[model samples]
Target: MPTHLWQKSSYSAEANACLYVSTPDDATIRLRESDQPDTILTTTPTTLHALIRSAKAGQLDHLSTA
Candidate 1:
């Protein structure tokens, strides 16, 4: 993967709660965390989009221990 292709989430820069992502191909969404960059979660754009929406809506709040 090209180094330039991976982008960190905005909050990653300001906090250790890092999230990184890449789109290696049109059909895939790749996710990583700074604490474990070698591991990745691959998904479809549609699913990722829905996840983002749910997260932003606080629907995922129950999963958080914070």
Candidate 2:
């Protein structure tokens, strides 16, 4: 099996927990947190785009109690 080179945004703090993303295949998107590397979430590009759009629009803010 080939290794996926996970990448995180340059804007994220180097010493803090960050979200890492990887593409194991053309149709798959993988996400994992720095603090919890064993847990991964997978989604498609379309779904990921929608998530970003919703996040940017603050639609998910209500779900967070913070």
Candidate 3:
């Protein structure tokens, strides 16, 4: 397994608890929460792209209580 060089989202709040993303290779995307470093999720680039697009378009706002 390649090392997951995670980077925090620029849109993340100025707190430590935020979402992180990593692409160890061209075909793989990894996501994890800063507070739960060990619990990482693997996804495809297409899926990740869709997720980001949806989030930016507020398509997932209903999932959040805030």
By summed lDDT, the worst window of 10 consecutive residues in model 2 runs over 9-18
TM-score of each: 0.76, 0.85, 0.73
For candidate 1, give the lDDT of residue 37.
Answer: 86
Per-residue lDDT tens digits of candidate 2, residues 1-66?
357889996766888688899998889999888999888898999999999999999999999977
lDDT digits (tens) for residues 1-66 of candidate 1: 456378888776766759988988899989999888888899999999999899999999999988
Q: lDDT of each prediction vs. the true structure?
A: 0.87, 0.89, 0.88
Per-residue lDDT value at 44 in model 1 = 100
Q: Write one digit per residue (lDDT tens) for candidate 3, span 1-66.
A: 657678998978988889999988899988898889889999999998899899999999999986
Query: In candidate 2, how many Å is residue 4 off?
Result: 1.8
Better of 1 and 2 by TM-score: 2
Per-prediction backbone clash count: 0, 0, 0
Superposed Cα deviation of residue 53, candidate 2 (Å): 0.3
> What is the full ranking by lDDT, best candidate first?
2, 3, 1
Q: Which stretches of candidate 3 lie over 4 Å from their true place?
A: none
RMSD of each: 2.4, 1.6, 2.0
- What's model 3's TM-score? 0.73
